[model samples]
Structures are given as C-alpha cells and as structure tokens.
Target: MKTFGIMTLNFESEALYIDGIAALSQSCGMECFHFLPSSINPLTQQVQGRRYSAIEQRWFDDEFPIPVLIYDRCFYGDDEHSKQCIPIVSWLKSRNDITFLGFGLPNKLELYGTLTTSRLAPYLPHSQSIKDCSEVVSALTKQKKIIIKPINGSQGYGIYYLKKNDKTIHVKTEKNKKIISRIFPNETKLCQWLQPLINFRPYLLQPYLELSNAASKPFDIRILLQKDEQGVWVERGKGIRIGNTGGILSNLSAGGSVIDFSTWSSSLPPAGKEYICSELNFIITNLPYILEREISPLFEIGIDIGVAKNGALWILDVNSKPGRKVVLQTDPDLKETLFLAPLLYGKYLSQSENKERKSNYEKTLYH
Candidate 1:
C-alpha cells in the first residue's frame, strides 16, 4: 500500500485535526506516517521512534508500512523549539528520496521591501505608502479624509484615520481617543503631527471607506479558498468579522466577532446584496490569478475583501496560511474537505510515481 508522512513541528501534539486527515487517508487505502520535529535526531539526521524494516526498506510505525510523503505543516522560525526544527525540514527537502507535498525550498515567503504594496494594491483599501508627511497631508487636503496603516502589520494594529477640515485635521485611532483633533492652520504643523509614524515604519495612506451604518464600524469578509484533489479552486468557507465596538479593523485577533454572512446579507436590501456578491466573486476569482502571477508556488490563498459604502469591493489582504478556526467554527461540515486534502495529494503523488516508473521501464526496454 502507498504511504504518506506529515512533516510537522509536533506530529501528535498540535493541529489535532491532522489526525483526522490521516484516518481518512487510511480509509482511502493509503498508509499514513507522522514525522514530528521532536522525532528527528540531532547528530545522525535520522528520525527516532520508528525504525526502517529490512524487508520493506521503508520507515514504518507498524500500522503504516510504506515510503514517506512529507506534508510540510510546521510553523518554524518564529519560536525557539520550532526554529530548531527548520534544520530537520531543510535536510528532508534536500534528500531526493523523500517527496515534499507542498511547495519546497526557494518558494518560501521572502521579505521583499516592495512586495506588500505591489502585490496587495488590488485588495488594499485606497492606500499609498509614503515616507514624506507633506505628501500625506497634501493627499488628505485634497481628499478631505484618509486612513493610514503600517505597510507590514497584522491584525488591526497601527491604523489611523484622519479627517481634514478647513483649518485643522482630526486623527483618530480605531478604539483610542482622538490623538489629533486640532485645526492645523499650517501645513507645517500637519507634517509635524505625522512625523513620528513616517519615521517609524512605511505607512499606507488610504481613503476612508464609509461604511453603511454610521454607528457600525467598517467591516470586512474573510474567505478561505483551497485547491482540491483535481486542483480545482473551492471556497472552503466564509465568515463576516465585525470589528470591535469602536474599532476599524474586524480581525478576530483584534476582538472581532464572527457573524453569519448570509444572515447579515439578507438583512440588507436586494441591491446591496447583489452588489456585495458581485464584488466578492470578483475578488475571489481575480485574487488567485494575481498571486499565481506575482508569488510563485502558492497553492492556496485566503482573501480578505472589504465592501465600501458605495457597494464597491476591495481586496484588503491575502494570507498564505489562513487560519482554520473560522472555517471550522462556521461550517463544521468543512472538516471533511480538509481531511480529503492529504488523500488527494497522496493520489497525485502515486500517479506521478507511476509515470516515472513507466518511463524508466520504457528506457530499459529500448536499451
């Protein structure tokens, strides 16, 4: 029987759902092996706990006796324990015998200075990254309002929206009190007010998206999209995250609540529903293509879309490893879809191996 292995930081420790995927693979007639980070030997570069059987010449756990297929799921490089696992992962990828299911080395996320702005323009709120506060003040002067966000930030942190009036500019945080509410009679004062942020990190200047309800903060939708066995794009699930009571960002990590989109959409008028749906579809369809062209070797994408008060859609952000919490919480049935991913990956590997074998046999016969 065919065998697949999951290469993760803690094989049996975290992401408990992965066990379900292994069970599914077994049901589909493939053996599953889990090679956790802790199992690796520091000196010999051999995995512990499981020994290779002489008869099979493959690593086995008694229950699973087949060659290994590594499912790279460990989040390394961030913490100390996970950081140590990076060497093991690197070693496995270098070896020709093991098959790494997902994108391998050289395709990892790189910190490019221009990548965030260039790749995320389509989805980002009306924003521009600028170093000069004068340019930001000028833009705000013309537009009358703008929102500023750090170029490289996660969750709902470091966001400021400024409202400009005749003589002064008012700047407010999502939840905090108004930082700048005085009328800046001079452009010099306006530039001085934004100097700290401009000097700290690159910031994006965005036009404030006026949400539908004046009382309700602006909200965005998080859609999880994945490729199935046939490599077809499928919507795993979607959830509407409402921002905190007085916050601008609707990120769950920032105290946002996940609400049912269908129910929320139904409460809106027919025209609003049509507008929202069309914009969402456009983002979902166009986003994957954009990532494929710009970011090579990305198999799946999680798109964050924002709907403006005028019924326009904008791509806010794209995540490489989108969290499964919202998906699993919103639609428990989607657990099956996640379970099926490894199985399909296994089948694809089997087909690839068979093709290689057939080619080798033909070469032998010809010689």
Candidate 2:
C-alpha cells in the first residue's frame, strides 16, 4: 500500500482533523503518517514520524521511508522555527519524486495583480500598494471610502476601513472580537497614525464598496472548489458569511456567522438572483483554469466573493489552504466527501504511471 503523509507546522495541531484523515486512509487501503518538515533527513531521505492504525485508534511508534504523496497543511509564520522549516519544506516541494496536493497560492497583492490583468478585471477593485502616505489621501479623496489590508495577512487581522469625511477620517476594524473605532481630525493625523502601520508591514489599498445588508451586517459568498479523483474541478459547496452588525470583515474568525447559500440566494429578487448566479457560475467555471495556468495544480481553493449593493460582484480573496467551516456548515452531508478528498487525490497521484511531479513551488511571483 502507498504511504500518505500529512505534514504540518506542529505535530499536535489539528488533532481531530488529522485522525479523521488517517482513519479514512486506512479504509481506502493506504497507510497514513503524520510528521513535520523538520523530521525529514536530508542525507538519507528518510522521515521520522508516527503511523496511524485505525484498528488501534492511536498513533504507534514507528519510522518509515519518505511518503509516496504529501498532503501539506503547513501555515507559515515569521518565527525563527517557522523560518527554519520553510527551506526544508521548499526542498521537499522541489523534489520530483514526491507530489503535493496543492502547492499554495501567492500573497494577496500578487494574486490581485494577476487577476486584474485577466478577464476578471472588470470585477476587481482598483488597488495599489501603500508606497506613500499621499497615495492614501489621493485614493480617499477620489473614492470617499477606502480599505487597507496587510499584503500577507489572513483571518481578517489588521484590516482597516477608512471613510473620508470633509475634514476627518473615520476608521473601523475588528480587534479581539470587538469593533475598534477611531477618528482622525484631518489627513495629517490619519497619515501620522497610519505611517507606523505602513512601516510595520506591507499593505494594499482598495476602494471600499458597501456590502452590508438591510440589517447592517456585512457578508460575502464563500465557495469551496476541489479537484476530484478524476482530476476535474468540482464545487463542493458555498455559503454566506454574515459578520457582526456594522463590522468591516466577514471572516468567521472575526466573529461572523454562516447562512446557507441556497436560502440567502433564494431571498434575493429576480434580477439580483440572476446576476449572482450568472457571475458565480462564470467564476466557478473559469477560476480553476486560471489558477492552474497561472499558478500551479491545486487540489482545492477557497474563494471569497463580495456583492455590492448595486449588484456588482468582486472577488475579495483566493486561498489555496482554505478552511472547511464554510462548506461543512452549509452542507453537512458533504462531510464524508470532504475528508476523503485528499486521500483519494493522493491515491490517484500514486497510481498514475505518468511522473508529473512539481519542482516549482509558485516562487516566481515574489519577484
């Protein structure tokens, strides 16, 4: 039987999800192991990890050869340990003998720049890097309301909504599950407060579109698309994330709630409903092709799309290592299939006679 490995940053992280995949791997006639990139031996090409036995319901002490296929779940950070493991993981990704499920996507700004040049440009908000404080003043003067987000941030952290009044700048953000508000007397004050943040990390600025409902809750459509065993892209599920009333973000991590996509879409008027369905269908059909051609062969992606009050659709974000909460909450019946996807894809990669392994880990975009 082929050995499938689940690699992560910490060994103890995602305990339940890890075991669920391991249990299903045994049922699918594959041996499952869990390990870290630091566990790999550079000289011997061996891995020191724990193998799972479904019958025993526990990980047993064992050593094994390098896995035939890897399901990478590593979320890189800026710590020394995380920094140390990045090169190790990159080296593993560079090997032609080992295959990964998804090689991950580039940072937010890179993704946005790529999509802006594609057919989706009409749906993209005008964005630019925060190179000068004057740029923010210029964008605010033109658009009235603008948003600033870290180029590499996730889970809605460090996102600020800035609305330009005649002489004051109003800022709102979610911090520690609470709404944080501040008002700057003028552009000079706003720039003073923002200069430190800009120096802290790189940020991308976009004109903020109003996406709240009648109840004042912000929302966006979260869609999950995954490749099946036959190497075809399939929509697993999509749902609506309604955030806190008057909040700036709709991320579940930022205290947002889920609503079934069908129910939400059905509540719309005929024209609104028609617009959403048509545009979403167009995106779902073409997005996978876009990523594969421009990025890499991905096993799954989570797409965040926001619809404006005027019925305009905008692609907010794209993630290669997307969460399952949106799909699992809306469609509980898809639970079994969701857990089975990685293993089935791994098996397909192992059984195929063609050696189509990846050496490039989507690194060219950084330049």
Candidate 3:
C-alpha cells in the first residue's frame, strides 16, 4: 500500500468533515498521517502523543516511512504560526520522489489570478477588484443592482447587495438593510459608504441575479466535481441552497437549506430549466479547460450558479476547496469513492507493482 501524508490544521474532535476524509483515505489503502501544526512544540519539536524532532525545522513521523504522496490541505498563509509546517510541506514537494497534490507552489495573488483567468472564470461571477471607488460605483450604476463580496470570503460571508434608485442606494445584508442617499447628484455616495468595507481585502462587484422564491429568498446551485482514477472529471452531486428570506447570500453556514437540484429545476419553467442546464454545461466543460490552461495547476473545482428571474443563468463563484456536505447529503454511497479517488489511484499503482513482482517471480520459476 502507498503511504499518504496530509498536513492540516488541528481539527477538533467535533470536526466530522476532516474525520470523514481521513476515514476515506484509509479505506482506499493509503496509510494516512495528519500533522496538526497547533499541537506541535517549536522548542521540543514534538507533537502531542508523538515523539519526533524537526530536522532543519521539518517534522517527520519517526514510526512511519516516507510518504509516497503529500496532500497540502492547509488553508491559511504559509507564515502563520498555525501553518509553520509549510516549510516542511515545501521540503516534501522539493523531493523528486513524492507527488504533491493541491496547490502546486504559488503565491496568493498569482494563484487567484490564475483561477480568475482560466476556464473557472465562467463559473465565477463577473467581478472587478478596483481600488478606485469611482470605477466601482460606475460599474454598480451600470448594473443597477449589484453584490459586493470579499474576494477571499467563504460560506456566504461578507456579502452585500446594493439596489440603486434615482438618488438612493439601498444596501442589503444577510441580517439587515441600510439606505444611503447620494450626497452629490454626480458623485456616488454609495461608493463612499462601501470604501471602508473594501479595506485591504479585495472586493468583487457582481451583478445581482434576481433569484427568489415565493417568500423572496435568493437561492443558488452548488455543483461538486471530482476526478476519478482514469482522470475523468465527474459531477459528484448538485444541490440547491435556499437562503433565509431577504438574505443576499445562500450558504448553509448562513442558514440556507439544501434541496435536490431536481426538485428546484422542476419548479422552474421549461425554458428556465433549459437555460440553466445549458449555462451549467458551458460552465462545467469550458471553464475547467480554460482554468487548467490559463491559471496555475488546479485539478478540482466547485461552482456556485444562480438562475435569474429572466431565466438566465449566472455564475456566482468558483471554490477551489468546496465543501463536501452536499455530496454526502445527496449521495453518501459515493462520498468515499469521490473523496478517495486520488488515494485510490495511488492504491491502483501499488497493485500494478505487485503484479509486476509476481510476473518476475513466475519468469524465474519458468527459467
């Protein structure tokens, strides 16, 4: 069996998500080891329940052998104390023998730009990160109604939608709303109110798709994609997430309810359904290829798509490490399979090695 090494943050016992992935890896014939940075002592060079020293500031499991594959699952920056093992991760990738999965070494800005320029662009909502408030206001005015999301936000957080009228712009949040009047008929006061929010973080301005239910809650579709052993892209599952009434975002973390895409699609008109399917297909097929060619290395992607009142489909966002909640909810049976594909691929390679060994043994006997 191939050994797989995973470098991740300290996941609490309550974090069933991480546990699920670990279990799946083990089932796929990969001996998985999770290195939690928080539990490590810099002075002792040891983690809880283990005795090991850092060689040139890298932690290695003294009991287990060197890993055949290393999955870089750290979400935070490389410099954070919680991510101090990043240098160790880099060292692993430096070795020619170990295969590194997820985030082939790149800076943050370069990685973002790579994804934004790739096939993933279509799945991502139209966004412009501008420091100039004037340019952002102009873009918002053209759209009439638009949403501003933090470029690095997750789980429907830090999303604001602004609806503009003649002289007033109404800013709606997930919890409340604020109305601001245009101070100067020419200058956009709305931008001034938004400037503070933009801060150091990049903000994305996207046209708000009027996706609403009878109760007026906006909803969106979440599609999970994964690669099988043969490197075929497979749609693991799809779900419709309905946001809280009057909410600007639809995320489970934001109190959204997940529903089957079939149920939601059936509720829509035939034309709307056709439009959505066509747009989704375009996003899934063309977008991945585009991202692979244009962006840095990326093997998997999750797409959030919304259908407007006018029956037009819009790409909401593209997530590199999209949650697997929907996959488990929709098809629990495939959860292990989908999540362990990479590990399973490693296992298959190991099996091939065994076959080669047996063939050599048989040849020796025949001779």
Instruction: Name the top lDDT candidate.
Output: 2
C-alpha RMSD (angstroms) for model 2: 2.1
In TM-score terms, candidate 1 sits at: 0.66
Top TM-score model: 2
Candidate ordering by lDDT (highest first): 2, 1, 3
Tens-digit lDDT track of model 2 for 125-190: 877899778899999998899999988877788999999888889999998779999999999988
Report the lDDT tens digits of candidate 3 across residue range 1-367: 5666655555442245444555666456665655554544546644442212223322334544455665556554324663465555444444556554443323223334556756555444565665767766787568878877765566666677767668766776663332222333434566666677777567677777788877898788899876556555778889888887777767877777788888778987897788788788877877656544544334356778787776667666666566777656766787566557657555544444322111111111000
**Backbone Cα, N, C clashes tallied per candidate:** 4, 0, 4
Q: Considering lDDT, which of the candidate structures 1 and 2 is the better prediction for this target? A: 2
TM-score of each: 0.66, 0.94, 0.73
1-367, model 1: which lDDT tens digit per residue? 6666666666454446666666576566666666675676566655544433434534455333224666666654336786576665656655566655544212111222223446444545544667898878788878887778765554556777787877777776654322223456677887877788789766777777764245576577888887666656778889887775455677776666677778778988998898788868876776666554443333356667777776767766666555676677678888887778767856666566332211111111000
Error of 3 at 255 (Å): 0.6
Residue 3 local lDDT, model 2: 85
List the candidate 3 regions with Cα displacement exceeding 4 Å: 24-27, 37-66, 77-95, 104-125, 175-193, 346-367
Please list the C-alpha lDDT of all candidates, in the order they appear: 0.61, 0.85, 0.60
